[model samples]
Target: MATFATSEQLLVIIDPAARQTDGESVRIAKDVLSAGAATKVCLPDGPEEFARALGRRGSRRPVVIGDDRALVRAVTVLHRARELAGCALSVVPVGDTALAESLGVPRGAVAAARAVLDGSERRLDLLVDDSDGVVLGGLGIPPEPVRAAAPEPVTAAAGRTWYRSLVRTLAPGRPRLPAVPSPGPSRLRVEVDGAAVVDLGQPVEAVSVAPGTGGLARVEVRPLSVGAEATPVRACGQTVTVIGADFRYRADAAVSGPVRRRTWRVAEGAWGLTLPTGS
Candidate 1:
């Protein structure tokens, strides 16, 4: 069950974004897939329909055809249904394929379709959050907020001539300030497996949690530093927790929420993905 049979029946889920991004690639993928497997093509118009389509897939293998978001959505749907471990998922990268490439799926439509027809399923680790959110790749805490630009008064003596005035009128510019330590570092309490790795007393630059080898999550906390660079506090554990002021995080390709706290635990080999043989 770890690899698809050469002619396995496939439920091909064509994401909306894929059709809008490139119809030619979609057609090519469909043609290639239909030529090989007994494929049932599904063109889901929205997220809800997509989930419904996947949920109703029965025993057929789900082959997502879209970008990273589409793949993530599929994973999330199956994970929530508590059937991800038994489901071997495949993807035909149609738009943004960076995540697929990292996961060992080919970049183009034809290559990915071919691999789907002839590839092995590899069980991969995933992170499940307290909110039942699924993270296929990784997650990070405290994405830097965009800073507001302050207007600097133009001095008469040091004033730029007509070019500067014209530029100011055309596009108000922010000062190119040198990169310096943030005036205020985020005060987050980071804990791995219930042991406080970084207490609330210490301010941190960022915190990262990702699936590591052997069913453990690799957690790293970067302390706010002045002067010399400080080494990140690192640990590997089954669970990682971050608590502090409301903050946002980048999980995989999307930004989550301004939550006061969140915890993620690793599910070892929680899901299977179809990758190129020997990948």
Candidate 2:
């Protein structure tokens, strides 16, 4: 919850995808940043250069000008490097903004840049998996469709696609869990903390794990149903474990795993992001 003074020195990294996707917004973000502070801009073509730029970011605060995917990349990169604790990150969301908006980042380039220069820093909670994957908001299963009307077919490739559709941005070379065979809905043995909430006896329709109130992770489980109304069970805890046949789950924007199981623990206030003053 540290408050940096106005016109703070900043390392503004613009993701290539952002640059290609929305040059106008990028321009607006650059102009605003250029007009506001002592800024060093890094235009990295890919993840390596992006990582290298951040690794050498000296005393300047890191400001990302991109979409949610870019923000996720920056967070994951910094978290893996163990430098997230001291970093107060900012973003000028330039593309699809669902994730950024969910995290309280304003929706447009001008306002977002203004936020970077004038807003306050917020230490936020994140979820980290055993594979060291980090989620800024949350992850869910029965991988929700990017478009609800586009019913995705169940197949091995589709399982990977399902995971990827929800997956934000993953650093290149990161190990991806095996894709599950997708001929049917997975029956996951889900547990919140140590209590079993969903068992293998029932087919699971969906599952969502998110940071909940009281610094705990919230877990929701929906059992499959044909005729009756399905009741979803909910619980809160610091950790959630899912065990069953090889299954896949969406984390942030990325889908991962066909591993027998995976566990996620809440990392309370492990990182910070800049938002408007009143937010």
Candidate 3:
């Protein structure tokens, strides 16, 4: 880990969508970071501008102020710039909390900012797709229903606001399993490191690949559930190949493919991040 200079600057990128919904919190985060040691706050209007600002990040630490999507975007830019290997990236999560919580970032803005000021740098694995794009978290094939079921902007806001209270009240009435109409699984041929692993015509509901221990890749296949427990197929490899009919997949929340084949290779510890302790 590189030791940051005492007078090092900090660049902040706030997501545009987040700003529209909750600009005050964004402003508060900026104020707190600015008041901290040798930090400068930057508010990029959009992703393109954010990339431009980050391209010149230099020796200053970069702090992202938005949801998980925004954090992923920042990491992508830094990785492309080849700065991620040396620079520490921090995130002040806003909007959706799922990804941030999984990554161990604090929920509140003030606490997240404090984390930025007092955090250790660590090397985290980044998934690079066939296109050479980096994914911060695990990628999914045939994206989760929740992502596809996202409502309109206004409706989504209302849903999130009332989701907790509504779920609490209706928990007992809700069915344990969702009435998922079985989209019969398409045939897929999977190979790990150029060797065949799974060659079946079963219903593959979803497939995902993530980094495992010792820099090996862990591949998981979730076939259509026959019983209560969905059989999980796991494999370890350096390279993964998936060939099937046109099917879309979510790579770190962003939808990617409908192609016949996609390959993913493990780029171990390709980037570094500045995160709260025990993240």
Ten residues in sequence with the least summed lDDT for candidate 2:
168-177
Local distance difference test, per candidate?
A: 0.84, 0.82, 0.71
- Across 1-279, the per-residue lDDT of candidate 3 in tens digits comes to 444443568877777756654555677788888887676566777789889888877767788888777888888887777777777788888766566667667787888887787776767666676877766677777666543324323346646545533543454431122322324565677788998666766767777887665567888887778778687888888888888888666676566767888888877877666667655
Question: Which ten contiguous residues of candidate 3 have the minimum total lDDT?
Answer: 173-182
What C-alpha lDDT does candidate 3 achieve relative to the native structure? Answer: 0.71
Estimated TM-score for each candidate: 0.84, 0.86, 0.81
Candidate 2 Cα deviation (angstroms), residue 31: 0.6
lDDT of 1 by residue, 1-279 (tens): 366786668999999877765666788999999999898999999899999999999979999999888999999999999999779999999766667788789988899999999989999999999999988778777654434344445666445334344554465332332322333578999889999999999888888888988999998999989899999999999998889888778787677778999999999999999988887
Give the residue spans of candidate 3 off by over 4 A: 1-6, 147-183, 225-230
Where does model 2 exceed 4 Å of error? Answer: 148-184
The order of the candidates by TM-score, greatest first, is 2, 1, 3
Candidate number with greatest TM-score: 2
Q: For model 1, name the residue pairs that clash.
A: none
Pitting candidate 2 against candidate 3, the one with the higher TM-score is: 2
